[model samples]
Target chain A: MSFSPLIVRLMETLRCLPGVGPKSAQRMAMHLLERDREGALALAETLQAAMEGVGRCKRCRTLTETELCAICSSHTRDQRLLCVVETPADVLAIEQAGSYRGYYFVLMGHLSPIDGIGPNDIGAPELLRLLDEIEAEEVILATNPTVEGEATAHYLADQVRRRGLKVSRIAHGVPLGGELEYVDGGTLAHAFAGRREVTA
Target chain B: MSFSPLIVRLMETLRCLPGVGPKSAQRMAMHLLERDREGALALAETLQAAMEGVGRCKRCRTLTETELCAICSSHTRDQRLLCVVETPADVLAIEQAGSYRGYYFVLMGHLSPIDGIGPNDIGAPELLRLLDEIEAEEVILATNPTVEGEATAHYLADQVRRRGLKVSRIAHGVPLGGELEYVDGGTLAHAFAGRREVTA
Candidate 1:
């Protein structure tokens, strides 16, 4: 009786993604039916699979299908060179660069005082535990250049300095107010390769 | 174990909507969770319910929960004045304008020649059959101003004239290249009320 029950149900489910509104949801539903039903279905499957399968690595908070992330579990990666980021999306952004063989540690969020989100809310304690567990020679701050991201980086740098481990920040290839995802992969790779040590 | 599976899936669906891209989808998905999860959920439920419930009216191509659409079956509506449109969404847009008290006949699509769509493909035959079923003084063409929409209207008008029925086109209040859905409700309502008869 229904023209498109599965398609409609899928659109309803997709309305849960961050920026989608009702009108947008309707257009998306129509597009799914009209143009790219396969891609829509793929996206749906990815969502369900990611929801069911993807989890944070126990060691570094990177997205993983298992106990540890692929980067963290890989023996080929440099355990000594650890990069820190604000989210899993940022981790993916970095991975696209494809030059750095260093592992990453995701903060999962940044410190935002106005929003009442602090280090405790973003797994800073767990980060410290991760740092202690790994034999890292240098920790790179790959958080964004936003105010909250900067504060998170500063806070993280101070913590690692107290632990007597060498700390570094990613070079300023990223704009002050820009997001990591929007940046070109080559620029991000170059920034990673040209990171500067933060000794104080 | 997951913080937001529904939200992630919904964002994916939002991507298929008209204006939403990846970044916007992310923002929308986050907004739903952060600002109003219940409202978002209500919207989702409505989408599912409407998808499952709404069907083509047997009498008109307008969407209905029953065999006959509300306009077709309603005793209060003017049966003598029937309006024709291209899609179910167009029907909703016209209804929201609050001017037309007449019945509707939705074609579900316009005639697209290059894409191989024709009069028979988009329910034109069904509409021709409905002409005999309903006793109407005039049938107003409310299809969009697009070339394909124009062609379809012309085709329908010719068919209605052959049967010795009065056929008229909705006036050109909207821009030449504009869509009915994008026009303001008041403008569309006024246009419907002030509709003039087709000369050619």
Candidate 2:
């Protein structure tokens, strides 16, 4: 016998979440139905509000309910130093690190020609327009180190150079606290190739 | 720098699902916002509907939108046999195995006095009332093998026996496909104690 129609539907709909499968969906649905109805209802309200209200920031393309995101609207952030990344989550990661003081432009996704995603698809034109409008002296390409991310950064770097603005890509090397024995060949090669001069 | 207020709220609310932590919550929020807004909205609607509409089945107490669950309402299931389980998920597991064709009575939770849960809290009185009203000649206790489950089954068995019904606890032993050498000592003892004579 199957679960009631509503229970089944809830389980099926829960699979839309990343990394959630049939078993996890069933467990989550049952957990909500059996234990935490209040939490489930609150989650529903928050999801609806976010999905309907959250939109891309007009300036940086990061997710925001208002016209501009927190960083874009802030007066303290260095607007002259702009950083570009792949997704909003990447922005959060940098923010949590508590080092970067510059504003960001979210690309949402990297270039994927095989999937038919182009410069226009990832809002490249909008990024370029922001470059022209802002007084940014430097643009940091903080996209991931994957092939597609590298290709997207290279393409954006060419565009930034055309406007005579300084452009730089984030370093790719061995991660901090990583053991050399466990480090992969490609990372080792990058680490060696990008080695910096030691200070006296 | 943090996510916009709405996005942060969405991420926090998404943690209500079982096994989801801060990192998973952030990934899910970004995934829904960046890649699948439609799926996010649909999940929200389904969560709301299920949270508000789904209720306990009047007969079996499994989750359902109607008075009786599918198994309880079915004409094909055995009315003279009743299986008592700790949760609705247990009923689903038994049903998915495709062996049992009897009606089920969900206790929602096992007896756990440490957590302040008592017989009345888990609907034990309702289960007894149902037993008195039904034509069930045999009752099966299919609660988990944990301590609370064993105690619950033993208590319910006494009540069923007082009413002159045959009640039996599901067996505990080494599981199928598990190696004998790898099985735990308690299971080995249970297997030895519950051994039956083979028919010639």
Candidate 3:
């Protein structure tokens, strides 16, 4: 008749995920009890482990087991080519591509002054301070293609330029194999404006 | 960079959730490591507990911690009246209504000979035996409005009739306040078929 408070709390906690509502949470909870018991346990254990010990990498602000992340600890990674991103999820997305061997700087958020988010909120101030600490010759702004993403990229570019460092923003617009007719006008324009000649 | 097999395996395991893909699985895995460690551990504990001990009640076949379900065990419930359903989730739905005080008989599934499931697959035989043991006075069939649900209800009605017991199926068709003109053909037919005699 009654679920233990702990069970209800776990279901409530799961609702924090994107697109999950009460019905989905209930289904997920029932599923955990019915089918994926081991997986549920593993998730719980992982959460516990991360919450108690995990913290942001002091250098790049990526979620890490230690103060410094694996990228920062590794000597083989291309430290001179630093890729900056909005969140940890963004870092994972870039990593999935498996082409960029550069180290990373995770901002965790972006500048949104209207929503009360500022440079400090997204760790921009801290990132600027880290630039002097790390000898990265080039920085890539790999923020999303949204207006907020563009503004943040431009702001970062200006700050890095003032610091006398080379700053480049990741190309945004129409994707490869995309039809111009189907593409959003804004993205197409950005793509054309940022177009570069193909190199052999 | 390549993730350790343990990490990848955990991510794969977590991806079994309905909407969780590989990327969401990775984020969730990472989240488990970053936050709510104790809660995660508690979830694992509950999973193990449910997996180890929870099972169907001998009476209604609904999930229970004991041989008898909570609904069956409750002395306050109307034992003389029984509600038949296709799944335990249906039982939960009725319970949440707070109007249905009768005991339940969960079919667990409906007849699907093509999928290899039959009458016995969903504890129909067990239900048959339990009906005699309980000596219930009235049985209300509350299966879904689907073809399988209807077929299952008919099968139950036939089985109960042979024993000379009172059995009735729940009404099918358009929802409350639904426009007849807007209703689907199948629903309209069912609504017509289940229509009760009106006194003029």
Candidate 4:
């Protein structure tokens, strides 16, 4: 016999999560039912609030409940140095690195022609508008190193240069603390090609 | 900078599920916000309903939205042969095998003295009462083969035997279709000790 209808429904609904499968769904359902009913209810409330209330920041397009995300509204950040990235998660990653003082423009995705995602779909026009409005001096393209990311970066770089603004793509090479022996061939070649002369 | 307050709260709440960690929680939150708001809302509603509606079946203690679980209420099931299991997931496993026709008594957990879990915590007394009420001719101990599970099975077996009912434990040996070379030493020993004679 199958589980109770509600239990079955809960398990099925749980599969919407990225990595959860049938077994993991079942285990999560059972765990919630058995041990953490309060936490389950709290999670439900939080999920509902987030889905309905969280909206993109009007300026940067990162997720926020307010009209402007905290980064876009802050006066202390270097607004003239805007970093464009693929997703809001990338914004978080750079912030956690704790070095960058610039504001961000979240593309939310890259241009994927095979999937019919074009400039408008990734808010390229909005980004151009923001660049003109903010008159940023330097724009850093921090999209991932994938082919689509590179293509998107190049497209945005051309647009920024046409507006007479400096545009630079993030470096791609062997990662810091990564050993050369285990580095992939493509990355090793890129590292060699982009090698900088040592300056003391 | 951290994520939006609601996004941060959602990620923290998502960690209540089994096997989810900080990184997975963040990914789930971003995925739901970015791609699947409908699924996130549906999952929230289902989680709320399940947490509030599902309760233990009065007869067998398995999770159910009603007073009795489907197995406990079914007339076709062999009420005279009862299977005792440590958790509702165990009951699901046996039912999926599609061979056992007996009804089940779910303990929800096994006896673990070090964790301060005793007979009452696992509903051992309720199981004994069920045995008296059902007058089952045979009781199957389907608890896992772990030390605590074995102790619980022996304890329950003694109680059933005192009531003059036949009690048997499920077999422990090399699993069906498992290679002998890959089987562990404990299982190999158990298989050899429990070997049956050929009757051809």
Name the top DockQ candidate: 4
Residue-level lDDT for A6 in candidate 3: 43
Question: Candidate 2 regions off by >4 Å?
Answer: A174-200, B174-200
* TM-scores of chain A, one for each prediction: 0.83, 0.86, 0.77, 0.86
What residue runs in model 1 are displaced by over 4 Å at the alpha carbon?
Answer: A1-15, A29-46, B1-15, B19-53
Top-scoring candidate (lDDT): 4
Residue A170 accuracy (lDDT) in model 2: 57
The parts of candidate 3 lying over 4 Å away from their true place are A1-11, A49-54, A66-70, A73-77, A95-99, A113-118, A174-200, B2-10, B23-55, B64-70, B95-101, B113-120, B174-200
Tell me the deviation in Å of residue A126 in model 2: 1.4
Candidate 2 CAPRI assessment class: medium
Residue-level lDDT of model 1, residues B50-167, one tens digit each, is: 5556566788865555777656767888888888998766777888778888888888778998999988877888888887887888999999999988899898898888878888
lDDT of 3 by residue, A1-200 (tens): 54334445646766655456876776777677656767776665544444555677888887766767777788888878787787665665556555567788887767899999888888888878888888888777877767787788888887887777778765655564432223454554464346332221
What's the i-RMS for candidate 4 in angstroms? Answer: 0.6
Docking model 3 quality class: acceptable
Off by over 4 Å in 4: A174-200, B174-200
In candidate 2, how many Å is residue B52 off?
1.5
lDDT of each: 0.73, 0.80, 0.66, 0.82
DockQ of each: 0.20, 0.76, 0.25, 0.81
B114-181, model 3: which lDDT tens digit per residue? 88978888777787787888868777777776677767777877887676677766555556543222
What's the residue-level lDDT of B176 in candidate 4? 53
What does candidate 2's lDDT look like per residue over A1-200, in tens digits? Answer: 67889999999999999999998998899899999999999999999999999998999998999998888989998877888888887776666655567889998888999999999988899999998898898888777777788799889988888888888775566464432223455654454345332211
